[model samples]
Target: MDATTGINIAKVVGPSVSIATAGAILSISALYTPLLSNSARSQSSSKPSPTVTLPSIRFIFSRGSHFFPQAATFAAANFGYLAYYSANTAVKVLGMEMGTRTGFVAAAVLSIAIGPITGLMLPVCNNPLREMAELERQGRGDEVDEGELKKMVKRFEWLNYVRGAAILAGGVLGLAVVIAEGK
Candidate 1:
């Protein structure tokens, strides 16, 4: 096979590998978040209420708290794919010219991806938290306005769709870059 054909295959495969890696990492991280939160609660309160066992793994997966970590994974996967293409291109053009280490490249790409995605989505996440706090302030005892809460939930849902679109675009762009630059 030609070098171009080889690079094309790598371009197709890299994102899938990165996504699988990121997803495993995020799953492990997510398990730890509840543990961390529970530990903090235990430390702060003398007698904490019984931990609410999530009804099912599916329910747990559906929660808003899960979205950030998933977004993080998506960002990391995209960034990793981008960096691999960038480095592979560099190597083709500058043989024996040391490019950035894979880890550094991955981190930098992930950070760049995360920065914009998080910046855009975090406010949507915060809306529900802020609304709940407002409900508490009004002495309604954590009972938020149903309509407002629904609006916040819809906003978050829209953000998720947008994130999915961004990921798709990143994947397509990354592939185009590799195809265009390949020998």
Candidate 2:
């Protein structure tokens, strides 16, 4: 391929693939949220429904925090730059075909919408879990209620559903753009 063909391919393919990848990762991760509960209904209210112990829960919480930030950092940053470049460079500099240009321009807006939402929402959901994890680590696990934690896990799953839907929608839309552009 010539230099122009390479740049055009990068402009269209890079952002589309990035969004699809991010969406797939988030969606797959969401599937495991139910496991966090590990609920086995009890005969009596005295026993907590979720059997995952506090220490185990804390471990998961600690590990879970680590995963998103890394993904958000690398994936979000990489896509942000690519989509920005695609939208700007493809239309203004590269002068991509009208179909490809429209697709790239639309993708520039659609692709990164999840980053800000996740950025704002994750801390909201994670703060309580973080505090509970820290307390569990410091031998205050007794104070951390597993029932509340279960509720939070449910909320996490719900949040992930919403986020996953949005991100996956972007990915699907990006795929549509790819098809529309015939690239």
Candidate 3:
């Protein structure tokens, strides 16, 4: 390869790979640890505890705030990078050359799907915090409904998995394509 080509590869592929890898690590970490889903359980109990399970709700909510936002940031970055690569691809194809960017259009769309997932994630993360705070204000923490709380937390946790997988898939695929093209 020419020197300029090598430089371009280094500039684009190097940071893209690093960012993708870092985002994947963060996402997987959040999935395995309580960083996103409060439970280490392989599965939520088949029977959600009876009544307003305040402690469970609080646990997930507190921990959701702790790690989800950064994960969300990574999700955004994954989408942003995919969009960047897709733009490059579109331009190349339009120029009548096969894009050296190679692949990841589907991954890009999946990353965009994160938009709506995060849309759902917002309320799941925030509503609980607000509700809990309001409860504390009114001295009714016990009033949080277990069933509803479980549903909300489930949605939050499920959304995390969906986005995490998207981020990881998009990132890995992007890195692989860039590296292969670089080669």
Candidate 4:
């Protein structure tokens, strides 16, 4: 079904999905890389490298602290937009003279679900950071045990994995919609 104007639905939604997918992948990398770097730095037996400044570490931490929410918001917004676009496309297809297509329906349904799932997961995953900050504000940061910190980190990582999976799934489903157009 052709759009009312000259707009191509595929062209718009295709890139939206791609952008959302790329953002999700980049966000995952950003979230995990520092943990790997810190782990390696801690495990090193050699004297601490003088080149790696504390300020640099703090800068990385600060960037990460801000990056997740922004990236998640951008990614989620794109997915949500894609969902809205796809739903409209589905309605258009249904009203078309050729009748309804299963592929468009599938895309609409998947898009509807993916937007909210991706949006919600990031904040849930970042809960540990909020908890830590709260403890610091309460003057009880020192009270948080290493074990608790480790558990929170683990939980965050796991949630990120799930979030990544959701993003990936959305990308794949979006691809399916693209491919279905070929038939």
Q: How close is candidate 1 to the true structure, as a TM-score?
A: 0.41
| TM-score for each model | 0.41, 0.62, 0.50, 0.51
Query: Between candidates 3 and 4, which one is better according to TM-score?
Result: 4
User: Per-residue CA lDDT of candidate 3, range 2-68, in tens?
Assistant: 6555545544553354345346535543653232233233345542432233344566447755654
Angstrom error at residue 47, model 2: 7.9
Question: Number of the top candidate by lDDT?
Answer: 2
Prediction 4 TM-score vs. true: 0.51
The local distance difference test score of model 3 is: 0.50
lDDT of 1 at 40: 36
Query: How many clashes in each candidate?
Result: 0, 0, 1, 0
Q: How do the candidates rank by lDDT, highest first?
A: 2, 3, 4, 1
* TM-score preference between candidates 2 and 4, better one: 2
- What are the per-residue Cα lDDT tens digits for candidate 2 across 30-118? 65555556544443343333334445556655674576445434433433444444433222223344444455445444455556666
lDDT (Cα, tens digit) per residue for candidate 4, span 1-183: 544221245535543654475465446446653453243366552222212322333343466547544544443444444444543333222223321234433434443443465466446634554555456556665654444454444555565555555555544555555444334
> Candidate 4, overall lDDT?
0.45
Lowest lDDT block of 10, candidate 3? 33-42
Q: What is the lDDT for 183 in model 3?
A: 48
Off by over 4 Å in 1: 1-10, 17-114, 127-142, 181-183
Best candidate, TM-score: 2
How many pairs in model 4 have backbone atoms within 3 A of each other, for residues 3 or more apart or on separate chains, i.e. clashes? Answer: 0
**Superposed model 3: Cα runs more than 4 Å off:** 1-98, 101-113, 123-129
